[model samples]
Target: MDKHTIMQYFEWYLPADSQHWKRLAEDAEHLSQIGIGMVWMPPAFKATGLNDVGYGIYDLYDLGEFDQKGTIPTKYGTKDDYLEAIQALKQHGIRPIADIVLNHKAGGDELETFQVRKMNPTNRQEALSEPYEIQGWTGFTFPGRQKQYSDFNWHWYHFDGLDYDALHEETGIYQIVGDNKGWADQNQVDTENGNYDYLMFDDIDFKHPDVVAHLKEWAQWFLETTGVTGFRLDAVKHISEDFMADFIAYAKTLQPELYAFGEFWKDDIDTTLRYLDGTNYQYDLVDVGLHMNLYQASQNGADYDLTTIFDGSLVQIKPQSSVTFVENHDTQAGQALQSKVEDWFKPIAYGLILLRQEGLPCVFYGDYYGIEGDFAQPSFQEDLDKLLYLRQHYVYGQQTDYFDHPNCIAWTQSGDEEHPQSLAVVLSNSEAGWKRLDMGTLNAGKTFVDYLGRCADKIVIEEDGWASFPVQGGSISAWIEESI
Candidate 1:
């Protein structure tokens, strides 16, 4: 069973120091022991500053090497430390994935004066402020790094627009205009604010040939430098689909089997499919649609359509293209997208993503290691290890979905020759009751044990290849063969 589980190894509020890499390397054996196929480590590149998350990307070439951006190493750790961690993970049979942020750049070394028109916040298409001169943080000389890997510099011409005008002390979406420069045209984004192009300051114009060449060049160089197995393209919806496809294609040239995936980050299935289709389905996308559905059900409880958990979701439409996940760093606490699934429904969400036969599931480090923030409590980490164990072994073979129950739904996986780990997964959002499932006749004589050890009772299958079990209210259970 070639199932691969990617662990999102870092959260937003992690300690902003140089110990993360060493810690990850130290935990490599344990992670591999727990069956982690890949580790989606946080941005190794230097950010706006030492403490800033890698999303505010400053130097793509500098993986915590130079003493720029007010620090030598990244928030995670130093360059050599990161490399050591990658080596450890690889040695432990776990691949490392590098997070790539190409949509925008921030914390420039110099500010340049430029004329820009401000767009309405509600309606980004309409320019409110007339073209005015303001010093924009668009110039990046990379003085500290001294353009080691690639000396290609960045300026206003390399970007389409920005959000702030430092000279005016004002901030709004501004599309830098000139003979041929305004912003990325209407073709390159979701139609949220008429044109969702200018997301942040100094939005890199993918349309620029120089920018495209440099990004592609940097991608190959980064892959070679870090020896990463693949990439997690960040905020891909903000960039042009064409550019993303081209860039991934170029990176694949260096490593054809590179496991590239994108963060399209749309809740609508059609929009997501359009994006996938637009990019010719070059990379898999995070199943945000499934996440929203789970979130809604978790919040609504019995009143919500529990039977339609996967309804209208990308997983339902195209399972192979979907990468399932529960709560990530952004959704944990005090982040922009903070619609967290309540703790009660976490097991159900995890079961739906992990126990099911479709979609590659990603485990959040916040949930795994217990994330606590000023706004939210520690995440749900208990009993999750058993779920991962079930996924690694019993999750193989044909799947049977029992989505008919409104308050309670269940499924079973008939173990195949490769894995005799047949199991039943039942979840309830309301009051508990008996859920009858078909576990097949292969293990009819053998009683099934509660694999997670949460339930004391075992299920005895009748001659009809069915077994009835008690399901705790608002809880989930995975029952495996007694021998398992």
Candidate 2:
């Protein structure tokens, strides 16, 4: 199998307009200029019928062609507009990875029907049919306690500004209540259930064969139509593991090289590895625990040692598993660890992960340009230059070596036969003025250059055969020169 590296741009907050298509085309061109190999675009389907996050999906087939956002006129362009963006990326040698949400659909339509029940007191039983509550994270809670919607207002909707339907005794679908309440007057659903309103989203029954077939068809259509190289599965833990295994296997048949990874959202390495066991790692996963460790270490001003974290979990992962990125859209920002984007820890984290030999490395879009506040205003051109250059020139097709170290972490990458490029990176977050370390395993008495700062240091082997050097405080990283 050919190894691939990724420089991901999470276009999550991209505007839902025709202008965005042009902007994305420009962005794809820019990424290619900077040597980014893969670009990950956010979900482009219809909005969840609630927020603009795109995760709250209403219909999988509709790519935002509703009455409200008439912006996406098929007359303006067909799915071809998106394909053009992908083609532009391919022209620049950049692969496009689409971020997909297969777990659930926005239960908005269900909530709307439930609201009608509460307004009319004539048919109280229909309004009070089967009431179900959401049992996951909704980003809100009442003071002094944490509970589902059932624990709170039974009548209010949790997440949607509609009412929950009373369960029908015969069919599983909740019965809708009819009332004279105006659609605008319906209260916004709290993250919790209502006391009087009774609004809960209709969760997708993954156990249903029709639902599974629908998901597979959607995946097949995306791959066959857009020529998307891979997928980043959202909220995989919420759905059945078997469903994912089958879905991934089916997707690979369409595009054999397609890489599908999921966000399992667990800290335990064993638990995370379980999802990959039977499937030959068809569903690769990001290392959320290691990401958290790096963030925590940066905040404490401690040396960010990549080896320590890898030693704890790398053995458990499949050799071809995915292993890129420290901070993603879902995690805390890299700037959250410190106020500055140029913080030593940030570069060190990037260098170590990008040069590692194990899993493919991923570069977050915001991390490329020090995006501080909101993702909406992210600047992508600046920091991406250095990273994209390094990924292409040094990291791509290179064999990785994890150098032995305590406080300082280091790695070296040697390019393939056709591309004889090599680079070594060493990072120390310690405050010590100077530190000496062994580089005997690498070429002795050879000159090594730092890629980021352009500083060069000559390796000198002492009488005892140990390479020593001065490692400064904050963070220091160096890459060795290689025959191009």
RMSD each, Å: 1.3, 10.8
lDDT tens readout by residue for model 2, 267-363 = 6676666656644466777766566666656776654554465544532365466565666666633322332223446666666565556666777
Candidate 1 residue lDDT tens string, 1-484: 2578889999888878789999999999998988789999998988988788789999899998999988999999999999999999999999899888888999988888888788886777888878878788999999998879878999988887888888878877888876567655677787788888778868888877888888878887888888998899898888888888988888888988799888888999988998899998889999999888988988998898678888878889999999999888778768898868888888789888888889989998887887655754565556677888888888888888888778888888887888877889888889876688887776677788777665789788888788896778888888987865
User: Which lDDT value does model 2 have at 97?
Assistant: 83
Candidate 1: what lDDT? 0.85
Per-candidate total of colliding backbone pairs: 0, 28
Instruction: Give the per-residue Cα lDDT of candidate 2 at 105.
Output: 47
Give the lDDT of residue 221 in candidate 2.
70
